[model samples]
Target: MLTNAVPTTNGPVVGVEQGAVRAFKGVPFAIARRFAKPVAPAAWTEPRHCTDYGAYAPQPGHLDLAIEESCLSLNVWAPAADHPLPVLFFIHGGAFVTGGGADYDGSFLAAHGPAVIVTINYRLGPLGFLQLHRHGFGEANNLAMSDALAGLDWVRANIANFGGDPDAITLSGQSAGASMVIALATLPQARGKFIRALALSAPGRNIMSADHADDVARRVLEELDLAGDAGAITSVPLPTLFAAVERVSRRLADETEAGTLFGPVLDGTVIPHEPREVFADGSLCDIPLWLGSCRDEMAMFLKSMPPAAMIRTTERQVRAAFGEAGWERLLSCYRATARVDEDPYEALLSDAFWHRPMSDLARVHATAGGAVWLSRFDHRPALEPFLSQGPTHGADNACLWAHLPNFIDRPILKRMGGPMTPEDIDVAARFQANVLRFVTAGVPDIAEAWPRFEPAKEPLAIFSQPFHVIPLNDGARFRAWAELTARPGAVA
Candidate 1:
């Protein structure tokens, strides 16, 4: 069912699909940004062939990116229109700097359930972020968020022909992508525009202080060979700026233990408040959620470090990075909780970054009476650099892509030169099956009525060799982090 031109509410649309499994690319969901301004819908003259994706929105250094005007486009894959289906919108993560939606082929996830799968590319790094760009007469402060808003609005206005129920869209993302969901959901301008459910994997803090935005802008400017004080950087060649920002981001990611730093900022227009504050105040979209991090989140952070060093990292190190009382508190939790001292530093990395932030989000969401499902990935990928990568950030993608649990010695994927690995395929099927049921019915699969957080206790369903439950928030290890990093602020 490929058509060269189909009439849409916004404009005349022409799209093509390769096959039953993969179709719908280069669909224009919004007007293109021209000369620093997002224009109104421009009528099409020719039957715009949308079968192939349009030029990727300008990104820092992605190999496929072609800088062009027609970047506000999205690609979709869904069940044939013979039936109505839930919709899944994917946001790619690249530390808010790199990645294009075109990279993630959605045919795999489309098979998970009866839903339209959408993969997108949005403005990244200097182009999309840079709230401080508005200072001293910059074009826009929330460019990245504005682009995302346009994409979501497009989904809301026109997902029906693709056999997708726009009302049942579930927004999901990983890494920087995950953080984008958090920011958009918190932005009042985005309320009810698109998405009925939220799924964030390894989300970062979005609402930044003015100081934070200034620092980020300075960094970007400095990399452009201009004064970091924000002068003449924007005047530099766009491609040069993009390339320099990309290099500086890589260097900054290595400069700190915290990894990358590009993220959403509170610019008063698109972002009126901090996301953590929005979560605390219960203003976020009230919907079913699936949220959690991996067991060895720090594994990826320690990948370059000697495994021998990782195994022997001491409390002295943790304290130095954090503080004295904090280190001791976290150490107590690690030894008492995981029940394995195989790697002393494991707890250090877990508490400071993954465990604390993840649990805090879960607790706030659950406490707000939102239906939040918690999960912890304990599966270990130990085949190729598996131990170092562990079941880190994109572990869930294994389930989403190859349809397998975290592979131990096996690649978590079996016979992938074919369809998804049996295990991952099963997970992809079941994951969306339940979520679809929840989106349509308002109850996240009655049979899967997961547990809720109880005060200091955090419960997460484990998707591993055998499905089991693991107490996360209340676990001694997480509690140690809660104590160590506990602040009056909710940004954690």
Candidate 2:
């Protein structure tokens, strides 16, 4: 809903929040769309309307379902500030498969802290981070990383006229986006570009190896009866190429190069290291951290599962993935969270698969002396009924942006709001403010006493309609799980 434009040295700007300031769009910085590569855009004279978003690159098919590739684009929401505003650059996460920047309207987030909020589109799936045994055709990997890096370069070079503080930029992302942050954090060069980062709801272990990339390339070659070189891969249609990758994925086991679709490859180039591996080294030694997960992250994926069905699925999967001790540790967590002795399968999955990874990551942050603020995003009544998606992995974005129901109840949300409780709206506002604050000042304190990660006392600050600080770690439990994982048996 842009009303008018304001011209400047960089470009013409369109008003993002009618009552606030404006932002210009598509001001290119990097020369090529690929890695540290490509031709630069020619200089323009006329100020263009920054109202519209740029084209989103083709995205991979959704594993939960399939969607179109039309949602790629970047959006900025900047408000007038008495001083240069802090900038928040958000990287949208979609499992390296499906997602779009349009899903996040920066206005909701930017307005809260009076910051410049940016949401951008990046390449996805095989086009983003797939590797091959040998170079063939236009074969490449790490397109995802390239997209993010390019976007950052763009922000650094041009966000000035948009009222953004270049020196006060904070890179914020969730899930795959967070993974990108971890990768960038370890990059020797990407340092000094971003002042800080806030990685929300990112799973700790992702990324492939050089051999893994070669294996995937071999699989694609076998599927097409081609050679193991990159030169010939360009001949295949985009759909055919992606489908070939898919065939290997659905049929293979974990880390199996025999198959995989739309996931990042550890090609040892753009992504020099795995997230888990470099995280322990404290590469980004002093970057402030705010890490967390939802109370029912699995409930989102298991939206179709009732409590009982969730129990069955958790038992089956955990038993298969972790084995006996895994099962027991999960059982103990369930017993503690749900006093009725009923198996909270979703909760079990939440702690082991989601919560624990974040906790483990926090320990690394603490060791590095980085200020770490950890939390458990709690939805008082669970997040199943909204958006037909439960408190699924990426669901917390709703609260962070105050979209959907919360937006409806608030006057500022415009058409995005509906009917949400006041509590919902307030909590969302706090979360939004925290995101902006983190982006602007590298701190997420809602009010008095925004505490630090103190595993010795309260290990986490649980965020929800009624938020609180909680002590969730138990030495014995962690040790037991560690033993279970180390046994070479199972960890369910």
Candidate 3:
């Protein structure tokens, strides 16, 4: 069945109804040019049929979605309910380069959560993260972040029409999107927009310094042969512009500390200070958080590398960031914890990039009087090809969205661990329940079994076959990483 026309700030929209869930896709939230701030879309009187997804931001071809600048749209899935329901607004992750909200299907979560689910699309790659205002291109620093804010603003004003409580919204994301959630928490403009946050597999570092971002912009200009005339960027062909982005990314990967050219810039105005610092000082402690990463976050990347090469590359990087002595101590600590079939280097990269940073942030946030919950997805699915890699990156998403009809057919999940098993269903039910609990109740679990994260105890919910909560053993390995992070040039 199809849903009746629903009124929005911009206009009325008609959507599709699947069972008890009504899906409104391709709802334009805002509109923007190549390098300008997003503004609300023009008002329309006639009801628009939004049965299909809108175009996604331009990027290197990965998904088969249409690409265009007018990609600032969102999708909504509202379940049948008599009263208002909490909303889960999610941002998709692709390293700030590739991906769109349409990649995720919110039907399962909407019907099961009995909550309104909103997924959004934002600018990407050079179109999103390239800092060009300094070079007189336009007011383009953190434009994608601005786009996210605009989406939230639209939701705050229009969600109630669809039976969602405007006051209770949970901002959530995964990977690069998770980093944006953390960044949004520190922005004064985004302070009261969202009530809680859920960050999954957020990188240790995603913000780029102003100087580095400027350098990247310069390199991109040079690649496009527009270094002398930066204003010409507005007219460059899309394919040519993305090609330049790829070249600049490859050239600067080894030079930049964060190992990527595009990300949210530490612009003095938009993002005043480091997010971790803000969380450490208790300035944003009022908002609760639920954050975690998978056990083998780096396994997906390192699966193809020979063990010897993987160890050698990891050793060099670790030694450069941390001194030889620091590397030796870390090696000893990880060796003590490594499984018989596990590669210590893989574990080291995973912890350095994802696990340790999340753990540190949780500790600091808890120390600063914030209500927080820490978790780690440790269930390794029974699928093969890379089964020995254990619970790898994107595994959490696989379990979280397993109820979607096409979960087994999604290419990424298929590559990770797919063909959904009975065990996967069991894990997905548990994972989705915890998330829904937080969205509706503000706390994940009230029972003593899932106590709030505290710095003194460092408790973590381990999401495995038989889920359990235990105090994390922050032993020698953690200390070694902490010491390294304290050093001036350490990326973590």
Maximum-TM-score candidate: 3
Q: List TM-score per model, in order.
A: 0.81, 0.81, 0.92
Worst 10-residue stretch by lDDT in candidate 1? 408-417
Winner on lDDT (1 vs 3): 3
What lDDT does candidate 1 reach at residue 199?
55
Screening candidate 1 with a backbone cut-off below 3 angstroms (N, C-alpha, C), the clashing residue pairs are: 101-120, 128-144, 403-423, 403-424, 403-425, 404-423, 404-424, 458-473, 458-474
lDDT of 1 by residue, 394-459 (tens): 565544544233332221112122333555545445555555555455544453445655445566
Q: Which candidate leads in lDDT?
A: 3
Indicate the residue-level lDDT of 120 in model 3: 96
Off by over 4 Å in 1: 17-22, 31-37, 60-65, 81-83, 222-235, 246-260, 304-322, 332-342, 381-388, 403-429, 438-444, 447-449, 452-457, 482-492
Worst lDDT window (10 residues) for model 2? 407-416
- In the range 262-339, model 3's lDDT, one tens digit per residue, is 777899878888888889899878889999799888887776543313234445667887777777778787888788
Name the lDDT value of residue 397 in candidate 2. 66
lDDT (Cα, tens digit) per residue for candidate 2, span 106-195:
665666678888888776666566664255424366666666776777677767767788888888788778767767666655777788
